[model samples]
Target: MWLLETTTLKPQLFLGDSTPYYAILSHTWGSHDKLQNLAGYVKIIRCCAEAASCGFKYAWVDACCIDKTNSAELSERATECYVYLVDATDPSGFGNNRWFTRGWTLQELLAPCSVIFFDSDWNEIGTKASQAEFICHNYVAQRMSWATRRETAREEDLAYCLLGIFDISMPMVYGEGRKAFRQLQLEIMKESTDQSLFAFSYRLNIGIRPIVCHLLAESPSLFRECGTIQAPGDGPAPEYSTTNKGLRIELPLAHCIGGFYSAFLNLTRKVCNIREL
Candidate 1:
């Protein structure tokens, strides 16, 4: 593991299992800032100071810890860093923090055994365990909600950044555009039985109004197939494919109508009433 030397901000290598406790900075990277420059160094310095305050001698900041010019090093570091201190605090508090909306931040939020949230001013807000109820109920939906809204400098990064979330790894292929996201979904489906992975927007019409609705109604178990496959050692990889046609399901008209009503009713209670809509 490469750690930032707290004093000189130099990269130092340490054995993965033998490393000392360290703090990680998880924040959105601005398009214009160069990590070697003064503006970019500010966040790194602040994070290092924060780690020192917490009795940690080492810190890891993605901007400085990984050598972006070396693709191999970048890939290695991406999965190595797990614990994260997500900056989720804004003037409006944790609810409105932009970190929650990021595609890469989704993995940062879930994969870690523990995650601490800090506000814009670097004040302690809470931990992921403390916010269990909110995260459990809304985690997947929250990811879907902002998956389209978050921005990445490289389009392929939209999917590459999420490799750790599904515990899957692949070589970075730049210039794939939106195809990267499709490949990501295929990889996820091979390893996971979570139907919520397919809980993305789809077209539905109630009366004369066409509306966007989430497949499986944000339920992870609804569409999950009940079975398991035992692969032989050195067997072939699982077969999966993606098509331009959106995810489709075949069901009786009554069942489809009932699901729509149930989803609509659930939305009404949480967000708006039919009259308000």
Candidate 2:
């Protein structure tokens, strides 16, 4: 793993288990970094400067630190993360910050065990623990909703960035288009029987909606309003699998008076913090 020495701002190599305490810098790519030389010249300097102030000897920024030409990656084991909110000048703008609207930031938001939010002036605004009431936990659909409004320059990255959030690993194939998201769903189903995964909406009236399907959502945007959807914690998830025809699953189907059966999904939603099935 490579970590930047806070004082000299030079990248240093650290092998397994010998890595020192480090803080990671997270921010929106294009605007915050100013994109001087593709290494995010301004952002890196400010990030390491903050690390040095906080008594951290080393820090990491995704842009210059990772070798995009190869499979090199930043260490995920780092527990402390510093979130640089370049768009927000004050703490009041936290809710409307551009940081929440980017695809890659979703991974950065969820991965760190501790996060310190900093304003554009590099002044401390908030910590993740300070905003506990607004954060959701554990539910699959809610976690997906967090990324629905986020975006990436590449269509494939919308799914690729989420690989770590779901604890799924797969080969990255760039030219696959929306199939990448579908493949991600297929991978998620393999590890979890959470019926909430299928509870996403179709993003009614969005511009240029993808060809809709009943089995899975075409994009994460369909899950925008699903933050309230809750997983069936102890409810038995029906056995399901993918087949040549489509997704095959055993759902409790009830026939209505019109002779149409409605399948009962093993999922619920919270209203006033109370679960309703």
RMSD of each: 9.4, 4.6
- Tens digits of lDDT, candidate 2, 1-277: 7888988988898776788878898887653345466346767888888789888899987765666654326325456888887778756667578887888877777778888888877788988788766677567788788778788999999898888889888878889999999899999998887888889877466454334356787898888778888754765666788788887888888765545566778778777442110
List candidate 2 segments past 4 Å from native: 15-19, 30-42, 72-77, 203-212, 232-236, 256-260, 272-277
Estimate the TM-score of every prediction: 0.60, 0.85
Cα lDDT, all candidates: 0.53, 0.77
Clash number for each model: 1, 0
Give residue 258's error in model 2 in angstroms: 7.1
lDDT of 1 by residue, 1-277 (tens): 6888666777788764666666677777655667777656777887777666666678888876756666654333321222222344344455455565565666666655667766655666767676665443222333334344554667787777767655677777888776777676666665643344544444334574446653333321221221111222343333333347754432223334435432211111133111100
**Clash pairs detected, candidate 2:** none
**By lDDT, who's the top model here?**
2
Q: Worst ten-residue run, lDDT, model 1?
A: 268-277
